[model samples]
Target: MVSSFRHHRRGFFSTLLLLLAVAGCATFVSNISVDVIRHPSNPSSSLPAFHEAPAFRNGDECSSSSATGRVDIVMTLDANYLRGTMAAILSILQHTSCPKSVTFHFLAARPEPEVLANICTAFPYLDF
Candidate 1:
């Protein structure tokens, strides 16, 4: 029984040492800074123009409404994910029957004027 107790004590100490070593290693992570490249706004004229989407009407009761009758879509925009954001916007416009009625609300971690300009240039008709 004494031998067994000694072996158990040794195992416990080994595990404790291993845990402390791992904890120390984990705490020594270096801080990293990333630089993002800001892109200039592309000319809106270069982009393909899309025709206005037809107005939607409810089955029960509805009348003709303008593009101001919109569906709001909120999204986050950043320079790192600009391409992905543009693709998502394109997909939304393609799939939505009432593209003109769709509005986008972009939120950013930082104030990026270039990002806003790029989005505007890409989607000239976007109401955000």
Candidate 2:
């Protein structure tokens, strides 16, 4: 129908606008430090296996925390799906101008130490 086509067109434009905005921010990335990682991948405890990904540095245009606010991402956590989340986080940080300014919050229905510990093994920065 014509109405369905109109809705799809609007959705396409909205997505295109968002992608352009993100790309614009990416262009402002001035310094990229690849040597050091934010959180060390090695977890002390015997946790599930996970490899560490490289960290992303903030662009010069990014404001200091004393001035700018942070972005928090919330996601539900579990064992199975947790294995595949590193790439998604990496992609978000890679596309953003302020990588360190972003924090991830994982909500678990019934929190478990092993699951939490496993997350630590993967992304040791926060209490996931």
Candidate 3:
């Protein structure tokens, strides 16, 4: 019985490793241009506007201030995950003790002006 269990465990690990390798080898291609539409701000909108932290105002000289207690968040944005991304940003801002201390860096696959415009519209006070 122990030998049988060991064999099954080995097979399971092998399958898991195979899946990991396949997933690692998979390539994602974005052929379509992402269209970003800025949703009009509603007073009742669930997402709150996050304020910019005062520590980031020194124009890249503020790295020293970051040691005090600032957090940096980087995310890749695309049309495919817009809603979920928005939700996540909202959740982060809403739940954080110091929303202003968070800096967001968004990396988009393509140069989408509308995406940046929409992000600015959504989080006008965000320090990007």
Question: Largest TM-score belongs to which candidate?
Answer: 2
* C-alpha TM-score for every candidate: 0.49, 0.53, 0.49
Model 1 Cα lDDT, one tens digit per residue, 50-115: 333333323323224755456899999987787678878888887766666677899999998876
- Tens digits of per-residue lDDT, candidate 2, 1-128, equal 99999999999999999999998777655323322223334456333465755656789988887346688898777755654565577678779998888888888788777767766655655422
Clashing pairs in 2: none
Arrange candidates, best lDDT first.
2, 1, 3
- Full-model lDDT for every candidate: 0.67, 0.68, 0.65
**After superposition, candidate 2 runs with Cα above 4 Å error:** 1-48, 126-128
lDDT of 3 by residue, 1-128 (tens): 99999999999999999998777665322222222233334455433333322321233333455566688999988755666776777778776766667888998889876556656766777778
Write out the backbone clash pairs for model 1. Answer: none
Backbone clash tally (model 2): 0
Number of backbone clashes in candidate 1: 0
Those runs of model 1 whose alpha carbons end farther than 4 Å from true positions after fitting are 1-63, 66-69
| Off by more than 4 A, model 3 | 1-67
Error of 2 at 68 (Å): 1.7
